[model samples]
Target: MGRKLALLIATYAYEDEGLRQLTAPGHDAVALAEVLRDPDIAGFEVTILVNEPLHRVGAVLGEFFHDCRHDDLTLLYFTGHGLKDDEGRLHLATADTRRTNLAFTSLSAEQIDRAMSGCMSRQQVLILDCCYSGAFPAGWLAKGDADVHTLERFQGRGRTVLTASDATQYSFEGDHVSGSAARSVFTRHLVHGLREGTADLDDDGNITLDELYVYVHDKVVDEMPQQRPKRQDNVEGRIVIARNVNWAPPVHLGEEPTARASAPEQMPLLQVTPLSVPTPVPLVAGRMRWVFRTGGCVRSVPAVVDGVVYVGSDDGALYAIDATTGEERWRRMLNAEGVVRSTPIVNGAVVFTTADRSLYAVDARTGALRWERLLGSQTTLTVGIVGSLVYVGASNGVYAYNAEDGQERWRNVGQGMTSYQWMVLTERLVIVGNTGSHVYGLPQADSGKTWATRIPHRSVSGPSALSDDMSLLYVGNSRGELRCVGTSDGERLGEHGVTGKAIYSAPTYVSGSTESPGTIYVGNDDGHLYALEDFSYERKWRFVTGAPVRTSPAVDDATVYFGSDDGIVYGVDVTTGLERWRFSSGGPVRSSPTVMHGLVYVGSDDKGLYALQATY
Candidate 1:
């Protein structure tokens, strides 16, 4: 593994009276360095220098570059005043520097650039967070302005530079003297972005140079309007700035004392059995009971149970909101990671959620973390709970754990493939679907596979849905086809293909789902909600929308409620395929809703969680 190293320097207290002293930059260097040094976050061996003089900064630079190895990724960050001399030479000011004698008192751009260019480390990232920082890269930007094409100039190279603003603009910083939260406006967002992992555009667990710059640029422009962050990169391949904290390495349960002993000694492979799904409460629709706004995007469904609604956000917090008032009851943050897309499962007194690399079990009432089992790599997949066992599918393989105390029971490194890990479990079998185009049927008592069925033509789309009794499984593929398979032998019993577009959402089953028997609701990329009869695979009704329907539907007695990419939450009649009520959430509603006690709880990309009941 290549080594990651960083040097962070912030000179906040300057000697010049005109250069107003800054409070956020010094704090930023300390806070950011602390996170980088953590084994979980960036994991960089970091060195921080606050209010250091020019001589000290120069000495440290000499040691940092001279000791860097060829297989290392090195970062140099500065947060202080930046000025360009009359000859266009950028200079970083130190506390003892006099503005009149720039060459004698300050650190020159040539000094740092020469050192960086001569370093043995091929991947060098230089970040300037002070005023006029963007001037370093402004000379090469597209149209001599900041743009994507200009940003692309850094592609395919091993060297990159990032700046806070253009030469003509000043980087903004607020004086946060008293508040516990003190960070330079730019550094604050940068640290938060790197820590949260929400900046992973592809959700691949790694934040690339492009993704980080884009995230930071957008935030700085959005939050500080006057600032325009810029970047220049020469990275030959993807330069991973940080890994998502949620996808921690896997930990076996019996490896610790708090968990259970091990898997059962020896047992016969059990057959798949049916399980019952609870009925949804019928809501009248049209009136909002209450509305709650979170700090970030609410892209996951809200799971409502026992008067508490559980929802996860892009901010990486699992929130328990009051079902009656939409007020928060308790909240748990997922170890300073980014984005919680998995819908939480509330089993008994615990709320189970998969974020980054761990499957966290939190107290349902108090939002306290009970126990966390690491699932190797970055996994945003939802967990499956059957009886007292919790199953999670991760990048490494399939894992089973004891739910109560979080001990690993068994693990099967089946083909070692990645998964969204939306799984279905029965009393006897664990059914797993993956992007590798194979669905495996694992015996619940053992880690061996009973049968592996290949769904040729494409990968599995979203997660599979199971009938109440777990007798039949419904899975969709990237080819827009929906297949029904028998759980006992992993046999494909029937298949139906939609239009040309793929089905990104899972099939949801309602009562009477025997074969050709009960109804199944599924959303597809063709911007339609499909109502099909179970056994015969016949389309009963289809409601068309303006955009793709990647969010699963929540159905009650009379209505089908789901959101569309077109920014609408729709309530359509189940049988008639007619629009009953449509509410505009002001953003895309990809989060599936939970209907409980006549209240429909759902989340939107607009950062709002809404509860709707009948207007009458």
Candidate 2:
């Protein structure tokens, strides 16, 4: 078995009276030590020193590190006060560290570095939860953010460092939500990250050092906007810091997960798939590391373009989050009008969405309002952008507006077909349907309907999908039937029924790649997600979740991902229909999952939008 050892140093009862007395360091150390020593979390050999003498700090650290074996993992954690000496060197102040003679009394960063240099352990992690902790890197100060490649460049040396504050920022003492003598802001969240599932960004049950840093950094900064944590890594492999109690190591969702294992080596971040046309490309699965949050429920799937995540909230705001750090870039709000339930679409430099019965176009980078147009009524429908036109379906009608300005281009005000699911765009036509009495095909250049078909007893449930040859269009209906019709004419091709229950949304069409055969997936109120052979409508698999799955399904290379009203997101094998994993949200999940790059973005009625990493 590999050795896992950690030394915790917390000095709140400093001998020097001139320094401010602190209440958190002592408590923070005890709390975190308990979490780390738990068999379920870190299960480390924890040696805690609280208010120890200045002379003893150096000897103890050396004794701890010097005994580490080549394959052992060693961690050193400190909390108290951090200072910069006259020489601008970083020091961790001890209980007896006097301000006047700090150089002779305090332990320096170089001293720890020296002990670490001689250690045989291949993995070492340092966490400094004091002011100016970011200065722990002796020669690495004053450098701005490192590029993505920095982690790879430092791979050979498995030293990972995280600090509570940047060199210029202060480590905060958080508000006592309940009692006094509360933990320090950084350590409180740090403990929360280690002990709670909040820090498990991927829902994979294990929290990596990098993932913990992101979760803690965002939370600390959120509570105190002035403080920013910093992290530097030379880790060649993932350094898992803790395990979540609710999750086991990921296995197929219904199968037994393997015991938590060491962090695996990773490749670099996924780059954006370049846009050759204005449609989505099939996504390849990868690990996800972070999630972004908004003020209210996010019923819409997120739009990722360039490097930003454009998403809407029922709080009446359209937000842009940094795809890398999950930091808010900017926000454009609708000001108490209504919720923005429709997913946003990113095209060129602008992003568009529907809210409060109007269509809004905002600058993608700056979040400045580019233009706004009021439809007849408030809408939960998403707007479509093709070429230079913006199409919106509302209570009054389906209206087309010029994308350059808010000018109304055309309106087919009485077709009675409206839904927010999806709209199939073709080279020369736009086909859209809804849970109304009809489905319509209209010219891209005008609002004139090319063809309209009315169902005698059934209503279209969602949007439509065009066939590979662009000859047939596929749509679902509340009648529980999957219907296919000729795209050029109004001729009915075929229709198939499923459990005699109403289909809730649009069907997804997967074109057979060299690796997969074409398949179609649709969900119904019967609580089943039916997978059918493309063109043939032959049933392939029907997965059952006791609760209805009104949400649409998104796909990665090997899995079909969707959410259930039961508040869980399920990843199932596309071929075998075996569950791969399930992530629980706080409330019902009605919004569809959006798979992009290496993440799954979805929303819950619990007022949270989640970003989950792919797990096999």
Candidate 3:
């Protein structure tokens, strides 16, 4: 019988004071152990090493590799501190580590590579959840970020390496005392993609390294704009493992499978075809229409142009459907191993960045790939079209590309940058945010620094509505606090908290009474939809939903349409907070609803997409 194996090295908590500060407590080890112990993975041997005293990792690692058989699959994961020596060599810090005695306490990337070089099994994965791991000298680091030692010594064959950050960065720990030092932002999203099934883009049972990298890259950038992960691949050919396994789809409100329809009873049941009616005249009362459902989690805001709505899904596809009919006009498969978290930017004949870690110019009408340019190994945060340039943010940095050919124009790495999440484009500047709660303003001309401000809460999502005049910028944080910041000097206008729920979605703006000017609408994990009066920071009203509301809200005229985890899409009075109508779906409706042409478009976790009409 074939065996499966996982070896986890969590080297933070030990006698060595320096290493202890960097390693997470035992809980990190346990969490990883739990995943390795899953019934799905029971067939393989698992090994775990915590902070053992004195150069213990090498011997244990050697033993594990030596014992592995040809038919076994292996996963090697390490959670601790990583450093680069003076010579630019990557080293994994051991429990008894002392920076002064690198040779005695640290393990070099070359040593690990050499240890695994003789392994007969073709399916192996190496995950390093430590800072400075990108220094591993594999050809994975981009030109400027690569260290000379890594380029010369550590390259290996038939292996995939996933690192926490670039060579010069630090990996963080979550705030919780008992949790992993910092759920390597990359690992957290990788696990999410695996558990949610987005990593299996082709719907195959097993996930590929390519898919895993894309999933981790997109999710981490979406969740932690500050920390950009690095991926190194040096396989002679495509490495496929667990080829016959199927990944479960990520948990969404409407993802549940429905039973097949039953045949009509023998008593001559009449076939009822719903009558078609003439298209209703556009409501003169400034009412909005909610219509189509994507039946997947909606990550990006819907793009509406020329009566057609475009959006991306966790299902690895970009969908363009009729704004009124909810009928799919075309869906370009991203072929990514993860969900499309960023919204699609549509420009005439081209629609861009639904997924795949690249900026793709696709045929807007036919869903064909017109052109694709690999920007970096991170997810595209928020993309905007300004004249001839397409502005986008990825984990590695911010970039501007030619709107027509997707050519590189300019990129500005975030200053004091830990990670890059979302960016808002203003007339004179482009403002982007990081996980460290810092926001940077880059002048549009030379990408020169304008001004940088730090918000109170960490920004997990993108910035929204910097105002057409670029006066007030509205931003939300993971702590569920929404604030209006002055674009000029980054002065705090005011802030309001939506309970304690994290605001995972971007805030949307609606024109308030000419008196109020800017009213911000956003959703929270606390399952509430909120409307905040811009300047005064007063809570206009809040509507409670059945489940957590992580998707942003879409507003048109007087009504607001959004989806909730409760498996329902709601249409509510924007001013009164009254439910105008509610449509139940088969599963959760975590995706935001797009309102256009008398219809709302959203995707549920359920397998079927839906189109609903409001009956008065």
Which candidate leads the pack in TM-score? 1
Tens digit per residue, CA lDDT, model 1, 355-383: 56778888887887789877766663767
lDDT of 2 by residue, 251-300 (tens): 66688656665443332111222111101101112233565667888778
Per-residue CA lDDT of candidate 3, range 1-616, in tens? Answer: 3456677776544334343354342335545555445544222345665544334567778877788877656778877677676556677776556666666668877788887887776666787777553323344343343432333344566567776666455665554334434355566665556544467666645556787787778777776677667677676655433222243334468677544323222212112222211111111111223345554566566677887877777777778887776678988776656466566777775545645677777878888777787777585546878888888887766888888887888888747458777788877677888878888888766667888888887866565666546788888887888877888777778777766768877788776565665777888887788888777768887886646787777777777888776666677777877666655554667666666556666666764344444333
lDDT of each: 0.72, 0.71, 0.65
Backbone clash numbers for all candidates listed: 21, 4, 35
Better of 1 and 2 by lDDT: 1
Sort by TM-score, best first: what order? 1, 2, 3
Minimum summed lDDT over a 10-residue window in model 1 is located at 274-283
TM-scores vs. true structure, each candidate: 0.53, 0.52, 0.51
